[model samples]
Target: MVRFSYEGSSERNLKMIITFDLVNTSNSDGRTSLQDESRSGRPNTANNDWNTARVDELIKVDRRVKRKEISLKLDILKTNIYESVYDKLGYRKVSARWVPKMSDEHKRQRVEISQILLHRCQQEGDETVE
Candidate 1:
């Protein structure tokens, strides 16, 4: 079996040619650890086991602490937190700002700004500020 892997500036593609010996069989002699292969291909262990307390702690840190701070405290890579944790938990290592909080503040600010703009427009006849 031959496998060719090509890497480009932006992407990678793989091509494989299976030989007869590489084919799978129902017999135990042909079996291999699929999990091992998958795990080998997966990203390294960084944030696999997380408890509730740890998650909460991470969230707290994400709220106020910087990535460097969190990495220093947790002894993990900032990239791991940003890639794995943020993707899975929807919270960065720092600034785990909640959507609800932002939504409320954004709505309030928009309303206030619109009111101000409308008032200014009414007074000055300029609609561009809104």
Candidate 2:
């Protein structure tokens, strides 16, 4: 059957969109809408398998290595996956470090590197090598 549906809104300016949700009800089994019903029991979570595996690898490595290495591995995994390691494991890998905090030594080293860079910038302004 042919049906015409019109929807519009007026704010600041004005806009209108005419949506044609055409329905062939004669062969639709008495259905009038165009949406299909979803199946019950948990949605598909297949895409997260890689992250889950990475989390497992991290856990296994945690028993044999330091936390910093695990943190770096987690960063690599995130760079490659672009998603939360914990969320991807069907909430199973809760121990995965999504954002590992920098250690005091790491922070100190970063500060020293920044200071050295600043000194270099100041020196470049003060002298020219011939």
Candidate 3:
């Protein structure tokens, strides 16, 4: 029973020491420390480079592959597959299809094409257009 004096220790540090002591005594395992113990099982396997690459390859093979299908095929979670596709590979859903997120260049091209079509339509007049 160590005596913690207010003159020697700050309130916060004393509280922390007492909390640590309580935790150490209450711990079922003999190893009572602040460090994280080595965990078993699959870890963050789905978020690794290998899994990201695998998900990317699957998307390349089939743009319309559902997250559920990818999870089943890769033996990973649907949320993980979605994160890999959207966060890692930069893809998004458009019209029920997975497509690469549009870049500035692609957006400009789309706008240009639309403007050209509009100009042509005006020249021909609404009645002549169709």
Candidate 4:
């Protein structure tokens, strides 16, 4: 049909045909509908606000806490712990150290410090002074 004319690979077209056939058969048999049915399984509860807050607090207390340690302490999977720390809390690791993503204030401070050091070096007129 014109609706199926959208460019797609043969594999995709085959899958669409199979899905259509399955849906048609199910409808004819009155077994199911096209709508998604509720799945049964343990829902993802590790990356919630409570866990995020807990993880943030732990990070604040010790920025170098490992993901494995957090997973053990919080009873969450390592992947979930990583997601909470990085994606949700906006943290990244540097030099084997966990730190929050730098904001504008941090950038400004870094630039200010470097400029001050550079000016001091220029005034000293000695490049190799320790």
What do the candidate models score in CA lDDT, each in turn? 0.57, 0.54, 0.82, 0.82
- Model 2, CA-based lDDT: 0.54
lDDT tens digits, residue span 32-92, model 2: 5668767799864533566558655665555344435644765543333334333443222
Q: lDDT by residue for model 3 over 63-107, one digit each (tens)?
A: 888999999999999989888999888999888778999889999
> If the candidates were sorted by their TM-score against the true structure, best first, what order would they fall in?
4, 3, 1, 2
Q: How many angstroms is residue 40 displaced in model 2 relative to the true structure, after the best TM-score fit?
A: 39
Error of 2 at 26 (Å): 71
Question: Which regions of candidate 4 fall more than 4 Å away from where they truly are?
Answer: 1-43, 127-130
Model 3 TM-score on a 0 to 1 scale = 0.56
Q: Tell me the TM-score of each prediction against the true structure.
A: 0.35, 0.25, 0.56, 0.56
Q: Estimate the overall C-alpha local distance difference test score of candidate 1.
A: 0.57
Residues 1-130, model 1: lDDT tens digits = 3455554455354444344434454234555543433344666667665632354476564566565666666777888666544555555322445221235777899999999988888887855654
Q: Which is superior by TM-score, 2 or 3?
A: 3
Candidate 4 clash figure, as a count: 0
lDDT of 2 at 39: 73
Which residue ranges in model 2 land beyond 4 Å of their true spot?
1-97, 126-130
Q: Residue by residue across 8-95, what tens digits does model 4's lDDT show?
A: 5775565322213566677777877767678999988888999999999988888888999888988899999989988999999997
Clashing pairs in 3: none
